[model samples]
Target: MLSLRGVRKSYGGTPALRPVDLDLVAGELVVLTGPSGSGKSTLLMIAGGWETPDGGEIVPRPPLPEVPVDRMSWRDLGFVPQSISLFEELTLADNLALARGGPGGAELLEALELGHLAARRPGEVSRGEQQRAAVARALVAAPSLVIADEPTSHQDHRRARLVLDLLRAAAVRGAAVLIASHDAAVVSRADREIRLDAPAVAPG
Candidate 1:
């Protein structure tokens, strides 16, 4: 559902992404595996349309087209970054409701096994619960694609598996799932894997 060809990016004089080529097909869960600073997150941002690539082209999923790196809406693509951006004051369910413009909050909460904690703020929940809440928030929107960066961070094995399973279910339902991480558990569970190198810009 997404395609990248010869994508490159640089911050200051150093590159953050090389000429990476990637494709994520519908109904597949692709894992991006790399060490810290290997441009995994940068690649996710680019693929999600959050960051603009310095070179190359990206073809978005349906309802989007091949376009210059800067012109992509990336927001239309569901994203869950390493930090769960849940609100401290808002109840988890309310936060998800806000994300979805007030639809499917309960269902997503239940699906993530978070229905009981709907009234709790992020600070009141365990790390894994918060992470699942983040996933619920993303899925509440039901976007055509999901891009997750370091999604398994700070969670126990069972919880991590739960979160990844939730993501896999999304992929099964036909949303392209792309997770960028160094976690072996996640990589092994992925339908496919892409190993990325440190950002290396091509010669101009």
Candidate 2:
């Protein structure tokens, strides 16, 4: 389980996220949605340890005691940033392989209907294809915690459903999945939804 207690963030005295509390449990998929600048991405980044919050702490619990949650590494958490961050020099398959630590990239590609583009580099594929590839990479590692920001933004209805199904499957496999998206398709399929409001400003 991942829990955030009173998590808050600000930028140069401008509040981005207000005091917030959230819990992500294993075997569940949680969708975070709101308008632009509502701090959805900020919250996801904070959960994934990619960004620091001005206040509050994140506690992660690993299934096994041998691997302390506090000591968890990136392999313990799979994150897909809003920006599809793929290795431009490597083929899509190669990128997935790297994430998987070797082999098994083809299966994911086939599932997402990107098997035919496996040999192509990120630069060569369309943005939607690249986004799909990024998602596949995130799950290839089978991390305990999955954090994705606007994962379906570049996908169509069919592809979006495919991706959501994949995420749902990951949750069934005991991974806590947290996605930040405004798409109704994604929200409707989530086990739970967390809505964040943009920070309010005080009048001068």
C-alpha TM-scores of all predictions? 0.86, 0.91
lDDT, each prediction: 0.79, 0.84
User: By summed lDDT, which 10 consecutive residues of candidate 1 come out lowest?
Assistant: 65-74
| Clash pairs (backbone) in predicted model 2 | none
Q: Report the lDDT tens digits of candidate 1 across residue range 59-109.
A: 852343244332222335676878777767889988777667664679778
- Quote the RMSD, in angstroms, for model 1: 4.3
RMSD of each: 4.3, 4.3
Scored by lDDT, model 2 comes in at 0.84
Error of 2 at 98 (Å): 1.0
Best by lDDT: 2
- Residue-level lDDT of model 2, residues 150-198, one tens digit each, is 9999999999999999999999999999999989999998999999986
Candidate 1's TM-score reads 0.86
Error of 2 at 166 (Å): 0.4
